[model samples]
Target: MRARILSVKVGHVTGLREQKKQATRAALGAAALRLAWERGPENVRVDDIAEAAGVSTRTYNNYFSSREQAIVAAVIADRESRVAAAVVGRDADVGLGEAVIDAVAGQYEDEGGRDALLMITGSPALRACYIDTVAAIEDPLAEAIVERCPGVDTLTAQVLSAGVGAAVKVALRQWLRPTSMPGFVMVSGSVTDLLRTALTPLRPALEAAGDTEVSRCRL
Candidate 1:
């Protein structure tokens, strides 16, 4: 009974610690985004972001490597994980390319994502940061890809995931550019359409993965 009680107490403590960390991370990301929106990414400093987040400068560094990461965190918070979940939850019959494109587009279908997309499109610094941050989704995506392509090597899964990430970045750039309008205005076409078009090149690879999965199942 005592050991069980002790285990429960330890679990509670760990959960609380995680909650605190998540709260601090969210606060920092929100502050960074707000500051960057109002004053531009170039003008925002780590101290300023920390103060805005109601945390110490050291705490800010503990969470993010740079101001760019902190600022972009607001835009990307929980999104990569969500994408991986979406990809994994998709029907087994669904093509991997279609699943990935749909999952990626699904992230931007909301009104809430509009402002962040606008800000990223408008600011050169933020755009660069956004492009780089897309790569962070690769690890989670690789996990999902591995699940679908169990017969393939880990390196193959990683490469396919990285390729998907690159396609997303390219599609976003293509969609955001040539708009001939300000950031506040809506860009043409659905993000889904852009992602589908950009990711079309990966259909062959995804088909191969599906074939591999089918072969493994047969075996």
Candidate 2:
């Protein structure tokens, strides 16, 4: 009884710690975005964001490596987990490729709005960070893939998720192309369409993995 009670206490403490960390991270990201929006991305410093979030600069560093990442995090808050959850929540009859593409496109289509998108595209550093954020979907998406397709191996799921990330980056680059004007980007066409097109080529691999049979699984 004592061991069980101790385990419960430990779990509660861990959950509380995680909640506090998440709150701090959200506060920092919000402060970063507000400061960047009010005083251009170039003018917003790490110290400024930390001060606004009521945390020490050292605490900010513990959460994000750069001001741009923190700012981007505000726009992309929980997107990775949401995308994974959407994919996992799809019907069992849905193909893995279709589910993944739909979930990614759906989440990204509603990400922030014109103002936030323009803010990210206006600054080269922020644009790079935004593109890099697509990679964050890999681990969670891989787990979702494994859950949705029982016969799939971890390595296969990981490769598929990485491929999806690469496709997303390509689509984002095409959508956020630079123009002749300095410090300005020309966003072209529909991002959802671009994402679907970029991800289409990976459908075969994804479907194959999803259809893998336990008897045919490699050692």
- Candidate with top lDDT is 2
In terms of TM-score, the best-performing candidate is: 2
Q: Give the Cα lDDT of each candidate.
A: 0.79, 0.90
Clashes of each: 0, 0
Which portions of model 2 miss their true places by more than 4 Å? 215-219
Worst 10 residues of 1 by lDDT: 210-219
Q: Per-residue CA lDDT of candidate 2, range 1-219, in tens?
A: 999999999999999999999999999999999998899999999999999999999999999999999999999989999999998898867877789889999998858777999888889999999999999999999998888776788998999999999999999999999999998998989999999999999999987886667613221
Q: List the residue pairs that clash in candidate 2.
A: none
Q: Between which residue pairs do clashes occur in model 1?
A: none
TM-score for every candidate vs. truth? 0.79, 0.94
Q: Which digits, one per residue and each the tens of the lDDT, describe model 1 over residues 24-102?
A: 9999999998998899777999999999989999888899988888878887878888888888788867877677777
RMSD of 2: 2.7
Candidate 1 TM-score, C-alpha based: 0.79
For every candidate in turn, the CA RMSD to the true structure comes to: 4.1, 2.7
Measure candidate 1: CA RMSD: 4.1
